[model samples]
Target: LLNSNLTSELLYENFLKTLLYSIISTVPSCVFLFINGTMLFTLRSKPVFRETCRFILLFNLLLGDTLQLAQSQIHFLLSVCRVKMVYSLCIILSMLANLTNLISPLTLVLMPLEQYVAVCYPLRHASIITVRNTAAAVIAVWAVSSLNNLTRVLLFFKFPFEKMELYDLCSNIALILGVMTAEYDRAYTCVLFVSAGLAVIFSYVGVIVAAKSASTDKALARKARHTLLLHLVQLGLSLSSTIYYPLMMSLSKVLTRMVFLWIQNAFYVTFIIFPRCMTSLIYGLRDQTIRPVLLYHLSCRLKVIIRG
Candidate 1:
């Protein structure tokens, strides 16, 4: 009886650990996505800036991030409830999550790339990254991501997991998706992870080089540097979390697992909760447009309170 009780406790503990890690892994990304999306939209609304390729890329990136947020929420609810739904629902959400994850990073890579091109090749930038071309590129990104995820989904249904009592059926479906198309899925994920990282790294490097060499206005250079730094931080956080999935998937050692778990949790706190907590601070402290907008909104509410 004592052994049985101990065994039960162990199982429950393991279950909780997995659940906690899963939540920590996904929830923070969702929160950050929403916060960044809001910030991007606010930035877009400013009348001072022209609608350029960089702006278009940023908008598409936000849309992709928003999709990812929805996917993460769906995944979180599915994990917490442990409810088994129709296989179709599992496949749908899994595909959606994967598609969003893929597209978000791809589009994020493009934003900085577009900015680099615009800054470096100002003469040809207009023809090279027109609105029509930008829209087509965005569409191509979604198409590729969607098709890849859909193929994974189709392959997942071919796997036989007849007797497994899955704690979370959604996770089971995701696992099936991974295993059935393990080679392709792993390859695609790695490629995207590496490509996005390289793109961001090179884009920023180009930005830095351009900033250094260009005989531009000091104020513009200062603002560009600040913006680049903020973007680099965001990109670093995102890439860290994105790569973590593959790392956790590949590593098997207990100590390594523990370290990864800690890092994963830290990533969540930094990216997810920190962003929401710091959004007002970021606006008030950093962005010119956001500061006045925030102040106006606050003042309007205060006036209403005083009148009441």
Candidate 2:
């Protein structure tokens, strides 16, 4: 919400500006979507990925991530078009976004905990992280996230509104309609991130302890340590996104409209898309098993594009 809507210039008033932005947002998103799709396929293409517990977890994480990217692009495009959706439509879109977004961190927890067992409890890793158990874990992740979203939906109705179809810009921030809902949301997010953070930290510490053992393969311990650090970095990026809008809203108070617009786009890439892409990149490029197959599929895509 700018104080001066049109004192001098519009951020994207003309056709060229609109087209410019649409291209800017869409191109990278499309490339990443393609990459994510390939990664998902790669995870399933191999028998090893199917049988391995870690790959199963990675596949589950990628599923949530791919859907979130699709939904997030929709949200970003709507905002860029400066479209004001009706309240009902906004609620549905935003809720869907939240539902998809919640899946990552929840899945993040499971992935690390699985890795921890693979590293720390190596003897029991196979028996404990069986295919059946992995399926159950995936189900529980969705169930918890769904329950959280359901509660969010219920709290949404508690807000008494002037109109059911009032027009407003749709965003994640718009979900805070009532004081009670806001408080609940704030509390729940705090608890969720903190718990997730602690769990990842616990896994990291356990891996370090395992690394100290003479029986431990130093190479495996080093890889696990690096992976946990990547997870922490991912968590940091996810946490930054939760505050992205509010931080931009604050900047809008001081900055010129044009500058603010530029910064917002940069920030979106930094805080949101980068973290999402990091998962695929780290796994696809770094993991020995994934790298060869992922490269083959990606090269196939490149060849098709070249031939076209």
Per-residue alpha-carbon lDDT of model 1 for 1-308, expressed as tens digits?
A: 99999999998986787687767656666545545655555556665423565556655665665665556555545644456766566766677777776766677567667766766666787899887888889898988887887778668767665734434436422354444476776678778767777776786677677776656444654555565565566555555545434443454234464565566456445543443323334434475646675456556655776899
| TM-score of every candidate | 0.66, 0.91
What ranges in model 2 sit over 4 Å off? 1-13, 252-257
State each candidate's clash count.
0, 0
Q: Model 1 lDDT vs. the true structure? A: 0.61
In angstroms, how far off is 240's CA in candidate 1?
2.9
Tens digit per residue, CA lDDT, model 2, 189-290: 788788779889999999999999998878887898899888888777777777776777677679975676678778877777777777798889999999
Worst window of 10 by summed lDDT in candidate 1: 275-284
Q: How accurate is candidate 2 locally (lDDT)?
A: 0.80
Question: What is the lDDT of every predicted structure here?
Answer: 0.61, 0.80
Shift in Å, residue 32, candidate 2: 0.8
Worst 10 residues of 2 by lDDT: 7-16
